[model samples]
Target chain A: MNKKINWQYAMMASAFLILALVPLFMSNNYYITILNQMVINMIVVFGLNFITGLAGQMNLGTAGIYALGAYTSALLSRNFGLSPWLTMVAALVVGFLIGRGLGYPSLKMKGVYLSLTTLAFSEIIRILATNLMDITGGTQGIKNIPRFRVLFWNLDTNVKYFYFVWTVAVLLCLLSMRIAHSKWGREFKAVKDNVEAIESLGLDIKKIKIRAFTLAAVYGALGGALYAHFNQFVTSLSFTTDLSISYVIMLMIGGIGNILGNIIGAIVITILPEMLRFLGDYYQITFCTMVLLCAVFLPNGLVSLPGRFRHLVKKKGKGGERFGQ
Target chain B: MEKKRYLSITLAMCLALSALAGCGGGQTPQPSQTQAAGNTKEESQQAGTAGESSNDTAEGASGETILIGVSGSITGAAPINGLRTKQGAQMAADEINEAGGVLGRQIELFVADDGGAQDTAINAANLIISQDVVAQVGPNLSGMALAVEGLLSQAKVPMLTGATSPKLVTTIDNPYLFRIRAADTVQAKLAATYATQNLGCRKLGLFTNSNDYGSGALNVIQEYLDGIGTAYVAEAHNTGDTDMTSQILKLKDAGVDGVIIWTDDAETALAARQFHDLGLDVPIIGSPSISTPQVSGLCQPQWLDNWYCVTDFTASNTSDHVTKFVKDFEAKYNETPELYAATYYGSIYILKDAIERAGTTESDALLKALNETDNLQGVVGKYKPNTMREMVHEGIICKLEDGTAVYLDSITVED
Candidate 1:
């Protein structure tokens, strides 16, 4: 078991090392920018994984939380000239409060009702962002958002932003991983599988559910803050219902109850559309087809591919020997 | 068993890495592939000669090709606008290339779809900039233009778009950005002026949608009406709103002599139909949307009678330039050129003129040439950039007569 854990750590380290060296070989700002975006998506998905994956709560309000974080940080930074770091803290606090406020009220409603509430929350945020012209700049959106700066190093370029975003993403991943492995993580999962069982265990399922939501909101806001600083712009159009759905799709495709699955899913889903861009009008159709295929064939998600592949390989090996003899 | 699991995982990682590497490799071959497939023999020979002369004259100006990036919504909501813009820009590029190209070099256009979203627009802008294009043509929506203005300014690439927001050029103060369409404020003012001065409207009823585009137009029209001292009653509706019965009743109860509608095509049609159903015979003035084929087609022919719209382009106008543009656009795309198509088509020509006058694709030179633009004729109108980088200031008010939008009067605002 210890050896297996060591192997997993080694794999993770190598994977990260490769990512770190990518900018050295790939110098195109376009690809690097896409990478930065992918990392931001991963960070958001990691937070979302806690609620939808571990705690078994569907969060369709991610885009709303994301917009709140972005608008809060952008308004603060643009209006008061606050540091990016300071705005990020403010965003996290706002996200936590909103998530708690939302989670507490909706906890009694399960499944589709909760989903509808979250969806309504997202639409409400978008409408506010659209109508609040004085503060949110209406649909024209807020521009010239200050980039992330650290001492003398300004993260103005994509390469610099790549490091900044990935650094945040890695830290968030570590934090999420820690939570996933803790006693609280087990309780969250217990609530997911059977709320009655968790209640019988004397755990306050409501508190655990709200806590999951709060943690997810923190990650979502952190991702949003990083995104606003990196893109250096924020618009209500950036936080549509489509984005919320895509985040849910990424979490599902990456696999529920798996940390690495979130990262892999985010990367694939983000990069796939870009890769298929050359297909012109057919790209969206092809992308949806591929996603549908993945969902149908890989029921456990892409994270289970390795285990499935190994099982198939062993079966094939036995069949080959039988046929040869 | 553990070993097999480890091997499979390692293999999966390798496959993923290779897939990423494949994407990188895929991009490098595109330019060469297009060069091989898209260039004519004569053009290739000219490019070779131009390449040598360019290298001798300047370090970076000798390339045989100049790429202008075009970004807009080729898919998702409002794709019709994007499609028209793209077709118009492509038509311009093709025409230029046919006419010996610009400055002895072929024009290459890299078009990306923004999906009409802010984040996608940013990505498209970054992608286009990475190609080292001299300028960009779109991200056609106002919201999209605002989102990408920062990135384009950072790259020092000039962008000419049809987004009607005045802030695209004014509030942002990004010199690299220019607009080919008249701003919404200008359109609103024209509507207001025509409603009062030409139609003899004293008490006006203003009906507008609630979105940024609609509300922005509403505010400008309100300010203009106030300036003219015309008493007005105003009502707002949401974008997807189908019922305007209550609002229409209010306007009729107020006994307004004229009505100005600022909304999208579908909503405009709905309101017009509702007004006719209610037997309100007041002269109605609408923003550009009511003049669109989609909206005009939806209403009864007589329902649209005496209705006027302040539009950027009226294809039925008798100008020789517009006639030719309409003819050529139909010949090429088999569709009538709308305001979006006309404006984007004019933007490419305007950019081409700038590039030719500057004799180089350098950002500063192109900007200077653009700023000095004077009365260049195109499909939209005579192009002349004001101090605020607004290229087109003229709008035509077309009235619906006998089921067609006929040219009524031309209004040009002086800043």
Candidate 2:
């Protein structure tokens, strides 16, 4: 319950710096570009960690929200007269409103019910993106998305895109950390742990849930905006049910309830395919096998690995209380 | 357990990274380079007329690296055609490179899989763009190409794709977007002209799948018919739709003289089967999508009777490039390359010629060079740009008979 500059943050910063230097070491520009994409996914995953990890509210509509953000920025900058900067702001605002609307329904739903509602909400958004040819450009998609540039850094180069995505990611990481340590963060945890008990405290559980949803949407939208500029195009296919499921699984694999875990999960999943390229068609099978193994055996995910290692080291003296402690 | 897991994870990571590192740099030379090196080298050498023609390419930038990007559905349902295009492009690049690299620079190709989606096509385009390709060969499908058109057009990167729609070529006036294949209107006009003028068929019944490709071709066909004041019967079906009994029944009731099939895959063949089951003796006229072997494989062999198809790529072409490309492609991929692959392959070669002629990767130079290309003896067919804003030229037409698409005739826009 204390705000501390912990070992976890140190590990995350180290990982961030190492990932930032990946493009430099790799001979293949293709992988370097793929790594740049992984960082973008990390941005979205970190946001997912906010609602799913800290708040314990399961929203599987990250892809929809991500698409909303991307399309919003794309439409505004390309169709309207607004610059990409203002378009991003519009994306966040719209994303927050949509998230809140979807979240408000969750007040009546609980657990899997809420998850289903979010899933349905994502599907509905996807259908609209596909069917509405006049507005969203239908399945043909909105094209000519502007390249991203922030603080005078043009994201045209692989290294530059990497820097920009990571800069935003790190900033989002710090912000989420700060918020997770705040009082509102504790209320979110309280609502997650026991809604009835939190209701008895009269702390307004519904309000906290909505806030968490809005926060998650804001993160998703920001990531989507980054994706739009990075890819320079927005279409319905980019945000599918698979992408939505991947976000949740990414959260789980990285370690639920751990900030660093989200980053690790994002990197692992994102980099896994690229790493498996040597196996060719067999690589996907191996990758799936590894993920399944982790899910079944290491259900606590990669985040708990370090703690488990520490526990084993100390368990030499005392063995019984290992899991409980 | 934790230490073992840690060590295992570390070992796993190292093994995976090393595996990836090993696979990193070994990709086949892309379409542009293969065409430039392989085809040109053979033609440009040997103190003869071919050598003199090769000298034209040799005089320019001859060893400079020109990277061209091609994005298509390489691993998805459309992989059959996508792989062929990739091969064709690569072969063209190899030939061009061997002939003495374009502008003294060897052409390199960077291809990405679109997975048959507009977003993926756009992603593939961006991936290629980040790697700094001079031109792009495809984002194969009309919808996918439309999605990425803005980026390529804005970047002023010329995209020479065998896209089938007039919409793709109309999106910009930037001269960067050029179609190697004929637009929909060209195919429609050819079909209409042939159906009415040559075949002496009248009172036609049309069965078309419900997609942009089908609808666009149908519209053009109908427009051509209307210009001739011909009243025709029509019906519509959807993609992936196997049952065409309802549409066929309606068309049969219309007392049609002949039937025209406008569809892309299984659905086209399904319509043919439905027509036959009903014992309808309607002479079948199919759109270009009906020319692929998959369509014939889907329908009964008897369906070939009175069944005619119009397409830009002739499976029966005896042209040197066409013959060699088809031979090489079949030898390598172990399958008869379809029109999609032929057009795509031709697009890659067309791009190589443009880039080489332009002598630089500058968008304007490439656009001008592409626009100036006249009577280019391409593998798909001869190409001559309209020099207009659209850059859409008339496409040649071929008719299918006995499983082979024989070159029936050609059409050019009248001055």
DockQ winner:
1
Model 2 iRMS (Å) reads: 7.2
What is candidate 1's CA lDDT for residue A8? 48
Once model 2 is optimally superposed onto the true structure by TM-score, how far is the C-alpha of residue A71 displaced, in angstroms? 2.9
Q: Relative to the unseen true structure, what is the C-alpha lDDT of residue B339 in candidate 2, on a scale of 0 to 100? A: 77
Pairs in steric clash, model 1: none
Give a tens-digit lDDT track for model 2, residues B150-232.
Answer: 66776667787777766665544546777777777677777777778877877888777545666667788888788888779
TM-score of chain A of each: 0.95, 0.91
lDDT, candidate 1, A191-261, per-residue tens: 88998887787888879989998988888988888888887778887888899999988987888767777
Residue-wise C-alpha lDDT for candidate 1, range B1-415, written one tens digit per residue: 7787668567756865787788776542232222222234543333233212222222123357677778868777777777777777767777898898888877766667788887778878877777777888898789889888778888888889888987776677889888888899899988888989989999999999877788888889888888878899999887668999999999999999999999877898899889999877899998898776756877889888768899988879988988988898888767888877788788889988998999888889998999999999987778998877888888999998866688877777864
lDDT of 2 by residue, A1-325 (tens): 2212345655676677666656667734456656667788888887787778877888888888998998899998988868888999999998899878877987888779878888888877777776565677644566667776667766676577778788888898888888887987788787778888887877887788888888889889988998887766676756777788888888888888677888888877876654543232244468778989988877878978866887877876476566558
Docking class of 1: acceptable
TM agreement with the true structure for every prediction: 0.92, 0.74
TM-score of chain B of 2: 0.81
Per-residue error for B339 in candidate 2, Å, reads 1.9
